[model samples]
Target chain A: MEQILANGLYLGAQYALIALGLTLIFSLMNVLNFAHGQMYVFGGFVTYTVVAQWGLPFVLGLIASAIILAVMGALIEVFLFRPVIRKSKRDESTMLLAAGIAFFLDAVILLLFGEKQRGVPKIVNGVFNWDMRIIMPYDRILILALAIAMIAGFIALMQYTKAGRAMRALAQDRVAAQLMGVDVDRYSMIGFALGAMLAGLVGGLLVTITGINLGMGGPTSIKAFMMIMIGGAGVISGAIAGGFILGMMESVGLTLLAAYGDITYLVIFASLMVFLAFRPQGLMGKPWG
Target chain B: MTKTYAVLAAFLLTIFVLVPVTISATGRWDLYYTLTSVALLSIGAAGVWLTFYIGRINIGQGAYALMGGYVSAVLMTQAGFSFWATLPLAGIFCAAISVLIGLPILRLRGVYFAMITLVLTEVTRLTALALSITNGAKGITSIPLPGELSIFGLTLIPDFSTMDSPKPAFYLLAVTLMVLTYLVLWRIVNSRLGHLCRSLQQNEELSASIGVNTAYLRVLAYAISSFFGGLAGAVFVAISQSIYPSSFAVTDSVNFMLYCFVGGLGYVGGPILGTFLLYFGWDLLSAAKEYQLLIYSSAMIALMLVLPNGVLSLFDRKGRRK
Candidate 1:
């Protein structure tokens, strides 16, 4: 149970970071940004390239990689999603655009990385010894800490910063915010850029703990996706809560079903299906339908 | 009357006429491969196109394909069921399972629906991976033949001893199921039911206001899609004669999803055309693994930017011009 709790919090941090970015895009732009996973995947490779391959400082690699992807995110918004955003294509089509972007990103990564898993340099190389086998990686703890700090910082920004207030207003109503003299488009771009940055940071943090691979996007994205869908698309705190729930569910469920032979994945998916069916609006978001 | 006959002649000439001449001339046995892969994949692609028509996407179609393939493959390998028996049984089995999944899932709109279906595929894949019934990823191989299955005491097998290649089975796949699916889906698109589905796609609220049973129609579409998917899986089983969870990964599901989108979502020909072009291109491009994902990603980005309506819609718009 302790391990499950720790695992949940640890993995939940990763989920929350990615989900935070996802929620930002969804709330501000009303887009799911399906390719968010691909960005996360790319972040890992870029971090690896900078820190390990180029012999750069780890922090510099994180900062540079995050900035680079943030720029890429802004460009993608301008060239790709801007038209679809204008067309009133609805959430479904926007999701497809996200899927396409992720697919393209993965294809690029696979081409460059050769489909092999590569481990990133651990940010910290110590362990937390709560029990005999309950020793924890210092980097994992760092990841969790980084995730919480990011969210806390995000909350502070949304509440305290001028840009944060503008983002909040845009989230509620882009046109109304526009009428109120907020640059809605710029806020949207900022939201997207920050979201991409968060995803990249999470990707960097993730490789330190779990290692990295081209295969991470589809499955990990689904888990993060479940969090967003369960928590409601645009809610920040909801992402955190949903992440905890999924991580707990996954760790506990995987443990329980290990004794029952198999069918654990089916159970989790079936549960998610039930959640979407019964609680479509989820906890934080309003009923879309 | 003549038009219908002409179309049938084209189909038949391609099957019985053109194919044989090519086989005789080339002696390469390549057309058999192209024909079968196209037929099987089209079934799955069209299944996805059903969800697309209803404004939903089932990334879990891979789950159904994988499930049906594994189920039939396991049964044929372990239980000694002939390939012929597995075909309809597997198809029916998959359709039934898919309907069960669709019941709750069809309620979700847009991306949520897509996510659940995507998760559903993962669930199926992981469960299949863990199940003792599936040999825990060792996969079921050396499946039994359909050699002795007879119609009125006339055996279907001409050469019973050799099980070397899947070429003949591929031709059988092309002639038998693929053509049938094309005709059935074509008819469905033109039916009153088809009009109702398109209406739902345009505006679900509007469809509901006009007395269309929106839920029922979506569910119905869901079942039809699953049925075709099962048929495709059965075809895949026939060709490969073995099954593994990896073959039906979520990537395959997404590829099928892209094919439908790339070829144009609302048409039968879209899947046929898109599946061949995209999948075949993927096969050729598989040579350079490192650059493969990069190319696919760039292609997708370009497609989104340049032709948001998809490759098939280009021809569709032109045909409409006439």
Candidate 2:
């Protein structure tokens, strides 16, 4: 039971990390970046290259991946998303554009790295013990800690930072924010960069836990989407709560329903259907205006 | 207008009749299968176009297709029902299932709905992998070719297995189905229900306020969409003679949406043209070997950017200018 709780918490933290970026982008741009998971996979690959190939410290590799992906994310927004947004009158094409970018990213990664799965070595090779029965690994604990720290730091930045204020303003009222001298494009870029950085950070952390592969992007993106829906679309706090709810559900569901094997997806989708039927706005999401 | 449609129908009939005869005469079996697959895909894409007409981006149309395939496959293999008998049954079954699933999902707006639908194929695929009836990933194989049609022991068409080359037969069946599917779609587009659906696309809330019964209309369109998807799927299984979960994966669902987008969502005929071009276009790029996906996806992005309304829009502009 303790093990399940710890594992669930660990899973929740990772999910929250991924969900943070997704909700940020959704709130700011009114678009979901389908390529977000591809960026996450790219982060893991970057960490693998930096730590495993270049013999860099794991911490430096994580930081490096975050910075690299943040820049890439900004560039993607400007080049791929911006042009399409400008051309189309409606936001419908954004999904296709993101899918296009995702396809391109997948193709590029497949070409560059082949299909082999790669893993980052654990930063600190040791185990943590609480008494005799309850055991936790140093890496898992570090993941949980770093996830909390990063999430808290992001919350602080969003609440206190000037750029973050501008983002909030833009999200609330685009035209009014523009009238107030906030550059919509710049904030959109920042939103993408920040969101990408979080995804990269989670990816780097996840590599040590689950390893990295090209195919991880599609499933991870779906999981993030599920989390956002459960938490409340475009609500940051809701995303965090939804992540934890989903993680616990998976861990508990797996423990009880072990014989089912991969029924978690079915359960998640079923619950999502039920949840949407009753409350489409989600638990924490503001109703669409 | 009637004269123009008559000429168009005659032209289509001539092409469909002549092309297969020419291909078979030349003994081009590969071209036969390719054309057959394209026709089958266009039928499925037409279903997707209906939901698009109702302002819903249905990324899960492939799920209905998969369901349709399995329904036909299961009924044929297990119950010994003839394939011809199962086609409409499969479509009806899928339509019923879509109505059940679409009720709750259609409430969410925009990306939230799209995102939910995104995982649908995955869920269905997983279910197929888990369920015993679906054979759990091994999938139901050795599915017999469609049985013959007869009236009181008088054979109308021979069984597919008896044919020396089933490709030509399958091609003709597929083309006939495609023609029928598009005709239905064309009729729908011109009907009163189609106009109500179009109103939802422009301003759903306003339409609802004006007593459009928007929910019922959305559900109706979705049911018809899934019905067509199922029809296409059943036809697909008839051609392939087997049904596998991966045969209609999430990528196929995405491709279905892309077909409508690339064809021009503005018109009913868009998916027919879009599926053919994208289908042949992908095959033409097979020579690029490992770079095919890279080049293909790049082209997809470049096309969306260059032709936002789709390839049909170019003709649309020309028609307007003239």
Best by lDDT: 2
Q: For residues A1-289, could you state the per-residue lDDT of candidate 2 as single tens digits?
A: 8888888898998999899999998888887888888889989988998999999998988999899999988998888788877876457777777787888888888987778999977787789887755588998899899998988998899899999899888777889999999999999999999999999999899888889999999889888988898888778888899888889888888887778776877887898899889988888888751
- Lowest summed lDDT across 10 adjacent residues in model 2 chain B is found at B7-16
What are the per-residue Cα lDDT tens digits for candidate 1 across B1-322? Answer: 7976797788778776787677869896876777678778888888888878877877778888887787678777778777777777777888788778788778777767777777777777787788889887887776655565578978666543365765865577556676788788889888998899899888999999989999889988988888777767766766666777786887778777877777766566778777877777766777866677567667666765665666766776697999
* TM-scores of the models, in the order given: 0.91, 0.96
Name the candidate that leads on DockQ: 2
lDDT of 2 at B110: 74
Weakest lDDT window of 10 consecutive positions for candidate 1 chain A: A87-96
Fnat, one value per model: 0.57, 0.57
Highest TM-score model number: 2
Interface DockQ per candidate: 0.55, 0.66
> Candidate 1: where are CA atoms >4 Å away?
A84-97, A111-114, A130-134, A173-184, A261-264, B1-12, B155-166, B286-289, B319-322
Model 2 pairs whose backbones collide = none
Poorly placed runs, candidate 2 (over 4 Å): B2-7, B152-154
Q: Every model's Cα RMSD, please?
A: 3.0, 1.8
TM-score of chain A, predicted model 1, versus the true chain A, to 2 decimals: 0.93
